[model samples]
Target: MVKEIERAGLPVVHICTVVPISLTVGANRIVPAIAIPYPLGNPELPREEEKALRRRLVEKALRALETPVDGQHVFED
Candidate 1:
């Protein structure tokens, strides 16, 4: 789906726990999730802490969209 969207000329970021899979699928903009069970949130953390983590993940995704790249790229903290 990310590939199809990018093929349409719109930038896309793939947020997933598996970075290798996203790269193999040809996602140019990639953001790593905390884990598979809780992709955006960590249940072990407090509510506020989980929210902060989610925010960081989204911010990275937005940053990935603005970056220019020739192939797959993964955004890091």
Candidate 2:
């Protein structure tokens, strides 16, 4: 639905582990997620570390949303 949202003149940032799929779906702004099962957090990590990771991911996503893109763009660390 990223394309659909953009079609309506709204920007969307797709956060997913699969970058290719996000591109195929026509997501203009993409953020690489940590993992498939835990896209936003790592349960194997300590609570604080996981939180920090999640925060950074979210910040990147927000940055992606704010940035302008002519086509599919993947925001990577």
Q: Candidate 2: minimum summed lDDT over ten consecutive residues — where?
A: 64-73
Candidate 1: worst-modelled 10 consecutive residues by lDDT = 68-77
Backbone collision count in every prediction? 0, 0
Which residue pairs of candidate 2 clash? Answer: none
Per-prediction TM-score:
0.94, 0.95
Displacement of the residue 40 alpha carbon in candidate 2, Å: 0.6
lDDT of 1 by residue, 1-77 (tens): 88999999998989999999999988988999989999999999999999999999999899888889888788888
Candidate 2's C-alpha lDDT?
0.93
